[model samples]
Target: MIEEPKTGMNIIVKTVTRLTTGLILLFGIYIVFHGHILSEGGFAGGVVIALSFIHLMLAYGREIVLKKMSEKVSELLGNIGAVIFIIIAVLGLFTGGYLFFDFFGKGKPFNLFSAGLMPLYNIAISLIVGAGLFTVFVTLVFFRSEKK
Candidate 1:
C-alpha cells in the first residue's frame, strides 16, 4: 500500500530544502571568495556549506543524491582549496622574507589565482570542516541506534 504524503509534508520539505540549499550555497560562495580579504575563508565557507547540506538532508529525508553529491564535492574542493592557502604561506615563508608574505615574490591578488594561494587555502579548509560535520551528523542521525 502506498502511503500518501500529507499535504503539509511536501510544502514543509520543499521549503526547508530549497531555503537551506540556497543559503548554504550563497554563504559558501561568499566565504570562498572572501578568503583573500579575511583570514578564515575556505574553511569557514566549507563548514557553512556542509551545515546547509545537513539541513537539507533533514528536511528532505535523504532523497537528495544530487544535493549529497554537491555536498561531497564541496568538501573535497574546500580541503584542497584551504590546503593550497597554507602551502602558499609556507612557500612564501621559505623563499620570501617573512611567513605568509606573498606580496613581494608572487603576483598581486589581481593576478590569476593569485593572492599567494589564499583562495586555495580557503577552499581546502571549508571542505574539510564541512565534511567533518557531515560525517558526525550522519553517524549520530542515521547510524545511531534508538533505545526502545
Candidate 2:
C-alpha cells in the first residue's frame, strides 16, 4: 500500500496555529495602534502582522491561506496603502506648506491621540509593509523553476 502526501502540518501544529493565529494578529494591530506611545513603530507592527499570516500559511496549506487573502487583494491593499500615504502627504503640503507637515494639533502627551497624523502614517505604513511582505512570501512559495 502507498501512503498519500499531506497538504499541511500534523493535527497538533494545526490546533496550536488555530489557537495562536488570532492572538498574533491582534498583537500586531495593537503594536500598530500603540506604536507612537511605545517603543515599537509601524514597521515592527507590520512585520508582526505579516508574520501572523505567514504563520497561518505555514501551518495550513497555501490553498487555505490564499482563500483568506488572495494575491489580488494583497496587491490592492498595498496600492491602497501607498495612495493613502500620498494623500496624507499632499494634504500636508497644501495645508502646512510642506510635505508631511503636521497640521493637526497634538493632543496630551502620553495619550493615544497625541501624535497628530503620526498614527495615520503608522497605519498606512503597517498596511503597506504587511501586504508587501505577504505578497513576497506568497510569490516565493509559489515560484517554481521550469525544466526542459
Candidate 3:
C-alpha cells in the first residue's frame, strides 16, 4: 500500500532538498569563515545559513523544522550572538587599549584564526543573521497559523 502523504512538498522535492541543503549549509559556513580572505562576509554567509534552514521549511513545513529548532532556541541564539558582538567590542576597549581594537593575536597570513577579532566578529555576525532571520520566518509562519 502507498504511504500517506506527509506535510511537505512532493517526495521528489524533499529528496532533492535533502541532498542539497547540506551543501548549502556548508557553503554558507565557508563563506563566513573565508569572508575576509574572499569576497563574501558575515552578512552574506549568515544569509546563506538562514536560507538553508528556510529551504528546509519550504520543503518540509514549519512543524517539522520547528521541532528541530524551536522558536525560543532561535531567539535565544540570536540574543547570544548580539551579546557576543557587544562583548567583543567592550573587550577591545579594555584589553586592546582602544575601542574595537584587535585584542586577539593576528596569526599566520591567509590562515583561519589569523585575523584576531575579525573571525570572531564574522562568527558573531553570522550567528545574529542566521538565527535572527530564521526566528523571523518561524514567527511569521506561526502567526498565520494562529489566525486560522
Candidate 4:
C-alpha cells in the first residue's frame, strides 16, 4: 500500500484544532463588531482574527494554509482594507464632518450599529491587520532563498 505523505500534525492535534478554530474566528468577529461598545477595538480584534488563521497554519502546515489563503489573496485583502479605511475617512470631508468623523446617528448605547462609522472603521482595520500579518508571516516562512 502506498502511504500518504504527512501533511500536518498527529490526529489528536488536528482534531483539537478543528474543534477550536471556528470558535476563535467567531470570537474575533465578535470583538470587531462590539468594539465600539466594548473595550476591544480594531487592532485587538484584528490580531485575534489573524491568530485564528495562524493557528490553522501551525496545526496544518504552511501548504494547506496557503491553499486556503494564498499570499496573493492576503496582499489583495490588505490593500482593499486600506482603501476602504481611506474612503471612509475621506467621506467625512464631504459630509462637513471632521477628517475622522462619525456620520451615522448613534443608536442605543451598548448596541451594534450604534457607533456609526466606528464599526465600519473597526472592520476595515481588522481586515488590514489580519491579512497583513498573515501575509508577512507566510512570506517570511515560505520564501527563503537558497545560497549557491
Best by lDDT: 2
Candidate 2, residue 27: lDDT: 99
1-148 in candidate 2: lDDT tens per residue? 4344378888878889999999999999999999899998999999999999999998888889899999889989999999999999999999999999999889898999887998999999999999999999888776443242
* lDDT by residue for model 1 (23-85), tens: 777978787778777565666777787777777766666546435564456456546656775
**How does each model score on lDDT?**
0.66, 0.91, 0.89, 0.86
TM-scores for all predictions: 0.62, 0.92, 0.93, 0.90
Q: Identify the superior model by TM-score, candidate 1 or candidate 2.
A: 2
Off by over 4 Å in 4: 1-5, 145-148
Residue clash pairs of candidate 4: none
Candidate 3: worst 10 consecutive residues by lDDT? 139-148
Which 10-residue span in candidate 1 carries the lowest summed lDDT? Answer: 1-10
Task: Write the number of the candidate with greater TM-score, choosing between 1 and 4.
Answer: 4
Superposed Cα deviation of residue 61, candidate 1 (Å): 0.8
Give the Å error, residue 44, model 2: 0.7
